[model samples]
Target: MTSPTRILILEDDDGLRTSLRLVLEDEGYAVFEASDAEKALLTVEDPGVDLMLVDLMLGGMDGFSFIARARPRTEAPIVVVSARDRTEDIVAALEAGADDYVTKPFSVEEVQARLRALLRRPTIGDAETEDADDDVLTLDSRTPLLFDAGAAVLRRGEEEVHLTQTEFRLLSVLAEHAGKVLTRTALLQHVWDQDYFGDERIVDVHVRRLRKKLEVDSANPQILVTVRGLGYRLDTA
Candidate 1:
């Protein structure tokens, strides 16, 4: 039988931690709790741990440090839970290697959905299927990007883009359908799984992250173009 999905919750708030555990356990996940970053670091040593839900404001060490430190130790996805919802906070967390972000006063349902989406995502090499047209695509009319499925590497100009699992999947889907506008609904269905609750903004966040690394200028992206109200298109022109 497949082992349970292990989830580590690092939150100083006792009440919120318990509440999150209860819901996660109800969904059949093996939940572990840590009240501080120090303890969370010890807990993260176990390679069996699958996912993490971390709060930025902890007792001792701040969340950013924990994320940067624990990231090297675990391939598990980290979902930052913070009261601060500023764009800088979100971007900082993402840059620190967080897979996703959740702000304070977030609905319990939303948190559960995000966890489900992360869990549903395929790990690096366990299960990655190829698209109908998995052939490498050219960028700028000269092959600058290379998708090596065997190595799970996406290289641009001799440098591999430091993309998380979710970012890689999203970019792959867009690249496969190069130049075609894909709606948010379609991206959610394709990348995050059809069961995702259509939180397309997650797509936007990840897309921005991808642009920062893949494009020369993320502010005015030339490759990944937004389609105003529709969605986005990958124009590697």
Candidate 2:
């Protein structure tokens, strides 16, 4: 039998942490709880931790610091659960290496759905439909940037570029529908595998992050171009 997926909950609130643990456990996940960043860091590196739900406001270290510190230790997706709903706070969490963010007073169903989506292994093309040519995605024939989906690696000529799971998935989806304008809603559905969650800025923040890594000049991107009132399109010319 397959081992259960483990999730770590780092929250200072006893009630919220326990409630989340119980909910996740009821869903068949092996849940672990931590009251602060220090405690969470103790086990965050464990390979058993498949995902993490982190609270931004903690006792000792803040969530942003925990995320930045933990990001280098594990590739497990971290979802920030906090009361801060400002766009800047959300962007800061993502910039600090969080894969997703959920404001407090969020529904259990929505949290569960987000967890499920993050846990699902997204791929550009599985073995069944994969081709030699399909393995690599390039912005242009002359460009050195390449996305090797099969290997799950992005390369710029001889150099390998590192990407977080969310960034990689976003790029994969865009590459799958190259040259097509994909609205924020479409991207959220395909990348995060969720319906409207009321914040499209999540998409914009991630896209900006991707541009910084993929484009020579993120401010004047030539590849991932934004369509004024429509959306974004990957110009793989």
The Cα local distance difference test for each model comes to 0.80, 0.84
RMSD of 1: 3.0
Kindly list the per-residue Cα lDDT of model 2 for residues 1-237, writing each as its tens digit. Answer: 999999999999999899999999999999989998888888886544889999998888999999999998887899999999988899999888898899988999989988988887564344522442475455644458888776777888788998887888888888888889999999988888756364688899899999998888789988899999989988864
Task: Kindly report the root-mean-square deviation of model 2 from the true structure over all alpha carbons.
Answer: 2.4
Candidate 1 has its poorest 10 consecutive residues by lDDT at 129-138
Rate residue 26 of model 2 by lDDT: 97
Give stretches of model 2 more than 4 Å off: 121-143, 194-198
The clash numbers for all candidates, in the given order, read 0, 0
Q: In lDDT terms, which candidate is top? A: 2
Give, for candidate 2, the lowest lDDT window spanning 10 residues.
124-133
lDDT of 2 at 39: 80
Specify the highest-TM-score model's number: 2
* Candidate 1 segments whose C-alpha is farther than 4 A from its true place: 86-88, 126-132, 140-143, 149-151, 157-159, 198-201
